[model samples]
Target: MKILSAFLMLLLPALVFGAEQTLVLDVSGHCGSCKKRIEKTVKAVDGTSSADWNKRTKKLTVSFDDEKTNKDAIVNAVLKVGHDADGKTADNEAYSNLPDCCQYRDE
Candidate 1:
């Protein structure tokens, strides 16, 4: 019984801490400022652990805690900051507010 109890205790932490999820999603933008903005917005989400945006690939790779947030929440946050992610478009006003050089629409 004691051995079983110890084994369960060891396993509990793994289960509780393994809710980290990683996703790579298509993100639209056109410059270094865009990269900074996308990554900063994603990292600001409640449970996001990290964010990386690649200028060449237009992909944002992020790691977040699923228990406190989800992909949709992160994507919405990105959209709010004027970047489109995972097939969702940013609000018109938000997109319009982005710097001229950061706009990807004309390209």
Candidate 2:
């Protein structure tokens, strides 16, 4: 009984939260503002639990519930905000809309 209880406790969180996926993508950006924008955009995606961006590395790490969202959705969200992810090109209009300092394409 004790063993069963322990097993259930370990399994309960996974069952309740659903399967989670973590992906690290090469995201383009240049500064602190870009990090904030990238993190905010990724986190706003449905099922995404958390997002962290490292400006120096230009990497965005995101965690989401796999049952609710997928990689394309997360990537699109970032692109929608004028940030390119995993080699995908961002929309021209959206990219142009970003502040001059936030643009990374030229760099």
Give candidate 2's error at residue 45 in angstroms.
Answer: 0.9
Q: Runs in model 1 with CA error above 4 Å?
A: 1-3
Tens digits of per-residue lDDT for model 1 on 23-67? Answer: 999999999999989988899899999999999999999998888
Evaluated with lDDT, which candidate comes out highest?
1
User: Candidate 2 lDDT, tens digit per residue, 76-100?
Assistant: 9889989988999999999999999
Q: Enumerate clash totals for all models, in the order shown.
A: 0, 0
lDDT of 1: 0.92
Best by TM-score: 1
Superposed model 2: Cα runs more than 4 Å off: 1-17
The C-alpha RMSD of each candidate to the native structure, in angstroms, is 1.5, 1.9
Models 1 onward score TM values of: 0.91, 0.86
